[model samples]
Target: MSEVVLTGVVKRYGPVTALDGVDLTVPAGALTAVLGPSGCGKTTLLRCLAGFERLDAGAIRVDGREVAGPGRHMPAHRRRIAVVPQEGALFPHLTVAANISYGLDRADRRGDRVDEVLALVGLAGYGDRMPHQLSGGQQQRVAVARALAPRPSLVLLDEPFSALDAGLRAGLRHDVREALRADGATAVLVTHDQGEALSVADRVVVLRSGRVVQSAAPGTLYREPADQWVAGFVGDAVLLPAVASAGAARTPLGTLPIAGPTTDGPVTVLVRPEQLRLAPASGTDAVTATVLRHDFHGHDALVALRLADDTRVTARVWDSTDPVEVGAEVAVRVDGTVRAWPATPVPAPAAAADPRPVHPVA
Candidate 1:
């Protein structure tokens, strides 16, 4: 196990900067996920850590040893860092056991290390099978096993589950997490998938525009985002204009308790869909809204609503017995405290016509 640290890491491609002063610490024997949209520097950061790309400026330390830094650059093969890439990239001609033993030392390859890692990834007794004989999920398991066979100090998984089907992806994530934990392997996973990052990693680092926006545990990140953009990006958000005072805020849905302390003034309230409760519209104290749509999931349903004031919101309903129908009036209430941020004024429209001439479509 190794604790990886990156300080002021920067990578540039001519005038374009892919990574901008990124400072991160990956704890020993824990999985840390780097999450972001495309072009957000996730891949660039991973490449830097793996020694595939040299840093323009900054330092990388693994287990307190400088691997890439000023006046030093260790090649990828010498870093003892293993990467499990997307598509499982296994050799079709090699059997499951052979592929996993590929990276091991000559003597270790002839030992039980292959079977040990296979069992860790839940692929025991299938060593003789070729890569094509296994399912997609099984192939990914082989990839993970191959990475673990050599007992690397650190592991890097680059969107390892992106190529799998939805059902397979979810199951593979759980299995992979368990495999890494069982082996006590420290890993860094780079993925654009929000759910995968939140569920699989011990900590998630969110990146945007070549910089880290936030880094927190999954629960903390979901329950308390840094700002409105992160709130909307991580999960479903119901943002509303509100007036805050004391410990509560008044929104179109009525007064609701704030998550934490905030200044008294106009604010933008963040109400998660799961925080909204719906009931039959009858009580005068309850705010009423018309159901615009109901999306049914197996275990839960999302009910979209439009308040009398035309404010649209969504509520998550766990009970599927009494389904909410479209166009039906329902009473809406907030179940718990909500997050609030200072209100950002909407930009005013131009008072005069544009100086540039508008071309009429022929």
Candidate 2:
């Protein structure tokens, strides 16, 4: 396995910058996920690491050897890297064993490396079958096995599980992660699925507009996001306007105690849907809201509500409890200390004037 280090990496296409001053480190034998929206620079970063795309500025090193930099550029074939794309990209004319053993030296190919890799990917005895005969998930496993056959120093997976069904994708993800870890292979996975990144990666690197936004463990990124945008992007959140005074923030929901010292002023409080609890309206301390809608999601339901002052919020409740009907008054209370950010007030829309009815005349 190899450690990849990128410093101030920059790549541009004409006037568009696909990667802008990005710095990242993928440790040896660890799977790091690059997560972002569709147009973000994750794919570009992967290609750059694979030596397929040269950097416009900055440096890239693998195992302390400079591969891409000011006057140094290594060809893709020279790098000991393997790539598994969205599709399997197997050769139709060759059998699974032949496809996996394509690039190895004649002597090495004669050994049992193909079967070993196949076993690693959970396809021990399917080497003789053609790619067309295998299922989609099986075909992807073939691709992964082919990449690992040569014992590459690093592996790059570009949304490898995207084309499969949810069940197949989940299974394949688990199998692939295990195969990589068992082989002690360092990997970088580029994906847009938040759950996939959080569940599979040892560390997550979030990118936006060709720039690195945050890099940390999945739990840290989910619980204490760097900002409001990160918080909203990571999970479901309800932002409310609040005022801080004497270590407590007063919002429309209720007066919530703050954890750290802050300047007394207006702030934005972030409360996740799961933190909001619902109960029958009775106590004066609990805030009252009318149910706007209830969306049943098998094990749990999301109850939409509108406060007395017209503020909207959502609460996730267990489906086993009595179902909350639309327009039913319910009491809502926060269960934990909510996160607050610098206030950025959004101007409410101006009230519309009364519309006078005009009769149509012939």
Q: Whole-model Cα lDDT per candidate?
A: 0.87, 0.85
Model 2 weakest lDDT span, ten residues long: 353-362
Q: Model 1, which residues run further than 4 Å from truth?
A: 345-362
Candidate 1, RMSD to the unseen true structure: 8.2
Clashes of 2: 0
lDDT of 1 by residue, 257-284 (tens): 9987788999999999998998899968
TM-score of each: 0.93, 0.90
